[model samples]
Target: MEFSSRARQRHLRLAGDRREPYPHSLQFYQEPPTESISLAEFESFAALAEDDYDARRKDHISHFILRLAYCQSEELRRWFLQQEMDLFRYRFHELTDSLRQKFLDHVNLSFEAVSALLSGFVLRRVCLMLFKIVGLSDAVDLFRARRVFIKDGFAFVPLKDIDAIVLNNYRKNLSKALALTARSLPSIQSDERLQPLLNHLSHSYVGPDYSVQKNTGKISLEHIDALSVKSFPLCMRQLHKALRENHHLRHGGRMQYGLFLKGIGLTLEQALEFWKKEFIKGKVDADKFDKGYAYSIRHNYGKEGKRTDYTPYSCMKIIMSNPPSQGDYHGCPFRHSDPELLKQKLQSYKVPPSGVTQVRHNLFGALFNEALFLNFISY
Candidate 1:
């Protein structure tokens, strides 16, 4: 997330600002650009022309700023990696053949050109002699596009499709570096000034602030069950399900789901009843709820405590922070916990249990595809 200084400044705010090529230094530099670039300048320079040093500097500095901010967690690292790969592929594709070769040389990414890609039939004797190994074509984007030709276990990757090699290499290196950076993050976190700034950037919300709700008190409590199934996002639908079945949500779930209900026009009086009615079903009585959970629900509407009326959490905020712990049913459905939890949930969804055991790497994905998410909306 961008800081206040960059609140209005989109790195790619310019209509033409979509290129991914940034300076690749052998070392990660600690000294960022001393001067600040305005939003107008940023838009003008978003192209990062090689001849223009200042434009390049803006791109380079912003890259480091985000790295420091996003290097805190596995989820953040994955998100950053995906974004970087997207930009990397974009910039690479925009290059001319000569420019592409120059970039390959500059980045020192050595792609083994196969006989199909070469001008003549010349096979590297060394690769031929070795045991048949897979190419860097394992990268999902390239594999999906059929850019990689595999015969007898060897991936014959063409020059036009060399992006797979580059991205695969970059992904490995960046993932390792992010992990290392996270390990050394405690030192950075020790700096009180820097810690909050990093936290803010990592959890930054860039879209419209949903804090303002003109349609408050419009949604009736009776309609929530149907509404959750019909219109709520996957994260909220899961929260709704958990709240109803378990009759309780932890602090994290309450904050995330409660703010959403408030934002969607549930009034203060309705909010109190909604939570109280649900909470009383399992553990708390009506009187206990009024004394306990009611204040917290009102607090979300700026009625108590700090009286800070919080907005509904943006999708980014939900993805980046407060990952659900054991017995918690809030957060990305696909990113939920151990095999036991997965098994229980999969069974609840009526997904075949056999598929869960078969999915070794991405257990949640194979079963919970488009249909499952559609169920969240269609139900």
Candidate 2:
């Protein structure tokens, strides 16, 4: 009855009306099969061995179905392509050794001899396909740099060079695609049947929940000076340094850093005293501090007004939201600080230039990876 009706709707949504044969050919690629497949059937097939008869049939068919849904937007298409590439890699890995060799030979991938020693051979191949727009100048540069082979004015980028180029291209496309997706999300989400899946696909967790107060009362104000030097995140460390040096923090800085201190176990009384002493050293008198700022500190600790126990900002939250203005020491250093200034700051802290570069690279990679994971759950 109701269940059957719902099932039928789902089938139609996934498999199409089934009146015409599902066109297996997608734009730009003609590798998929010509058969039609329902969403449920595609899922089952994708989960089976590649050698399975039905799985082979459905593999090619399922891609076209996904293409139909994903072709609505560039973001969706890129995500779909990446996911299909991942699936292809997995399936390729699962093939027999002989079959693997045969597949490589069929693809005319001579570099397989070099890449077999390294993992991600399949991924490298897929990424190469995604990043085929390498310009002639760039190809010539890569050739001159001995990083790629050039034949007949075409540069064949090596496996080692693939990651950087692929990641850069992915970043550019993904950023634009995300902006486009956000603009178009309202229309895309209008369909009740598609909204849940679309929302799920877009949802991503940046890191662990900072709202959970597992470390409450674990830190003491007496040790904060020492802890700030050693255990604090870069953002918090910068705030602490600014506070110690200037003896005053702007409202934004106070809120951002105070909440973090509260999360790390600064009592309401300790926080008040800390801020009071720091402010008094500057232009603010003790009386002004009590009148203007004490309530806010208390409020942050759930002792005033709404008594809401606000959580500390997570790294993602700090990075993505409410960026600090000029004269503010709060906000993510990675996001807020000027790059050259940040490098100088890091060097002043005794980090070597190479280490600074590595840190920057790692942070960028993490941010990009998180963005990719959240924006496209299928990948």
Candidate 3:
């Protein structure tokens, strides 16, 4: 039987309810539809179309990314470079050796494959999206985007090896490295006032199902807002506000905020102007702006900053690859997970234990998002 509206309200209260045994009920879980193509398939497809990929690859994938995102700002470019350097210095080595090796290999392979498979028009569009994923405003920005890409590439090596031992070895090594990093980082035991928000923000996008559900209209913005209220951490709250209010956020959050702003309706010119002025606020000079910011926009937008590119709008790669850490806040959640850790974190946030297990189990199944639950119960 369909759950009554009252029953739904009661279940939701469980988020805050701490009574013994906590209430249990069968509620409709609304799942979102996923894109049909797999990452392997997408990569292979791009590899097959190498000639096209190269032409675009040469034209600068970072610019394409920024232009798409509507974030090709003079100010944004400087900040991006600065952040890349900062992250590279502080967090690169935290990655596992095996994972790192895998990343280097995959990048070489992926590059060669794409070069061989795609070029020209086909490459341009595909790169447009990939550039965005790496947090570049455009294809030209990739040289700087390299650090982030390298870091994430290792984090997301698709286990295609037929050997179980090799695959298991890869998994264990990566997990230990990530857990070690998480443990070593200073715990954010800030005031309780920030705890609820911090926990929410930290956990918010952990599930693609959340985004999918909203896009498919199975869940309303109200529900999303509610989820955000609990899972939205201070970092994300600031991010959400920056994107929604059109303010430029500094440090590592700019690329994310910039892309999100584009998602909500900011324009390229507007976004650029906003970021340029923001960088200047931190004492950057006009000369730096011209060489760095202006250059990125022109190179990425393809018309000397006069045109808007669609790079910033592409979120799939970033969302599917990087997840947040002490320094890697530019990534998305659906892509990164530490199996046991993901479960514990979800449960702590009041997600039904069953839901947590279900999500973890379905992470690698053929289908993703809503398609996994077509005709299923509505959350």
Question: Highest lDDT among the candidates is held by which one?
Answer: 1
Model 3: residue 75 alpha-carbon error in angstroms? 31
Q: Candidate 1: worst 10 consecutive residues by lDDT? A: 359-368
Clashing pairs in 1: none
lDDT of 3 at 115: 34
Off by over 4 Å in 1: 1-65, 68-79, 85-110, 113-168, 175-203, 332-379
Of the candidates numbered 2 and 3, which has the greater TM-score value? 2
TM-score of 1: 0.54
The C-alpha stretches of model 3 lying farther than 4 A from their native spots are 1-252, 266-306, 311-315, 319-325, 348-350, 365-379
TM-score list, all predictions: 0.54, 0.54, 0.28
- As a TM-score, model 2 comes out at 0.54
Better of 2 and 3 by lDDT: 2
The whole-model lDDT of each prediction reads 0.65, 0.59, 0.37
- Give per-residue CA lDDT, model 2, range 1-379, as digits (tens): 4558889889777655442232321112234455554545643432334344344455455444444455556655555555544344334444565664454344333233333333533455544432232444545546566766444454556544543343334344444544554576677568675566444433333456655766666766678888876566667878999998999999888888998888878777788888898889989998898899999998888889999988887665665457788888887775567768877877676655666655544443234323422332211
Q: For model 3, give the 10-residue run with minimal summed lDDT.
A: 24-33
Q: At residue 354, what lDDT does model 1 achieve?
A: 53
For model 3, residues 1-379, the per-residue Cα lDDT tens digits are 6779999888768634532221211100111113253434322221112223333232232222222122223333333233222323222233464553454344232222223233433544444432222212222223343422333232211122112222333334433433443343344334444234433332233333322212222333334345443544323433554444443344446655554444334445655665576667655666786676655544344455565553442333344333466534354333343457545655554656566545555433212322322212223
**lDDT score, residue 220, model 1?**
95
